[model samples]
Target: MEKKIRFVNGEQVQTIGVFAGSETLRGYRRDVATITTTGIDYAQAVALFTDGAKWSIVEVGEEQKEKVYDWSSHGVAGPITDNRDGTLIIKMGKNNTVEQDLQDKVDTARQETAQAQAVTEALAGQGVATVEAAQAMRMMIENAAALLPDSEAAAVPSLSKSWVVGEAVKPGDRRYYAPTGRLYKVREGQGHTTQADWTPDKTPAMWVVIDIAHAGTQDDPIPAAKGMEYEYGKYYSDPDDGKTYLCKRIGEADGGKIVLHYLPHDLIGQYFEEA
Candidate 1:
């Protein structure tokens, strides 16, 4: 039997294959005849077979070009350019490691900025200038050192261990003192043997006194009292409300002594805030 020629859109063609399946074109699937034609260009073939529908012709295994993308919102540093040939060229500002380093620097800068803002707000609340507050803090620290006793008069307790000379100590090591009956913690990065002159009370820079009653922790906050010196950023409990507050500022120095003018209740929003 002789093969019969098929007609599509008024054009004679040969139907190579026919099956109960669909073919996708330009992301759209349509049920249409797949025909082979001779002596016809792409435009002529589409006009004859597609019947004024939008269609494209390609050889078998030929890939279609994808649409260009807008890479501006991708968060990549520097400019990105489409080369129009199925390739993109990106001019990066830095490599992956350098990019991570830049991100870390940005995070550090934000934290510093937040701290500076807090300091500025604290100064604004108390009507005290930055220089005056800083000078008061410096004098308070200096006078506190001069007030330290040369040696504790009380004898060392039998249960508590006395600070022996040439004893090995590292940072964060705690030792009990007989005079104040308090423990002192070594300063950070200060690992050394005990020295006779560098006692816990005498050397405030190397050792910090730990008061269990006024530890500045959430559980045991320093009680708010008049004439009691409060450290900045330490937690304090208000006697009036019994709520915990963080000390944002301390009273100015008077005669080389830190004198707290207002209690935690009166100093709320000025020198203290809810912790």
Candidate 2:
């Protein structure tokens, strides 16, 4: 007789054959179903026989089940495939969050790099080679007249006073004396209150005459003097040479005053022609 055995939690199966009335079989020979344990907790065994068959029990140990992943809960709408070894392969679509974040970072970096390159090129066009050179140029342009004297003191306004008695004066101070119709600068280190009969023209030691006539003008330029502040773009007459010069640059002197550096006569042709 043929018999079949079924078990729950079972994986592999084997088959055996038995003969009746054999000398090796003793007593009542009946077909019996036996199973080998494989360390799994199985349910009760059941056997089905065609005529005379018996049943047998098999005990096995328990095992842990594999974990399954829920892709939808993690905002993953991609197609996933299992490699059957606790790993997965996923194909990300166009709207993937991770890819979009990385692309945004790359775009920001490119924009910053382009801006820096533009600044470098602009500075190079102005003959500035490095960032430090550019910064120094900016500082000089901003504070070009910082070392010069105050504008109020340097400027000879239209209405000015003449040297009078008991009038206070300091170094670099200028006063228009009505008698001579000329401007005079207080001599260096000569700071004191004026006294009677101490007029500017009479006391050459206390005051230095700046101009014989009036303030500088385009047509009648005044001679540039020491301890005098010359303004940019103004016209002045050079003392050494009688040629009228445009104040191209103002430089700092020993006592924090501005000195004038005129353009050379040869270079004047390059900047201005006969016209």
Q: Each prediction's TM-score against the native?
A: 0.25, 0.23
Worst 10 residues of 2 by lDDT: 17-26
List per-prediction Cα lDDT, in the order shown.
Answer: 0.50, 0.45
RMSD of candidates 1 onward, in order: 25.1, 38.6
Best by TM-score, which number? 1
- Model 2's alpha-carbon lDDT is 0.45
lDDT of 1 by residue, 1-275 (tens): 11212332233323222222234333334332333334334444333333222222222222543322221111222223343553333221212234455678999999997786676557445544566775675455434433443223112221234566789988866566666565565668877888889777666666655443556777889766543456776777876788998777546332232335467778777777898
TM-score, predicted candidate 2 vs. hidden true structure: 0.23
lDDT of 2 at 264: 30
Native RMSD of candidate 2 (Å): 38.6
> Candidate 1 — which residues are off by over 4 angstroms?
1-160, 214-246, 250-275
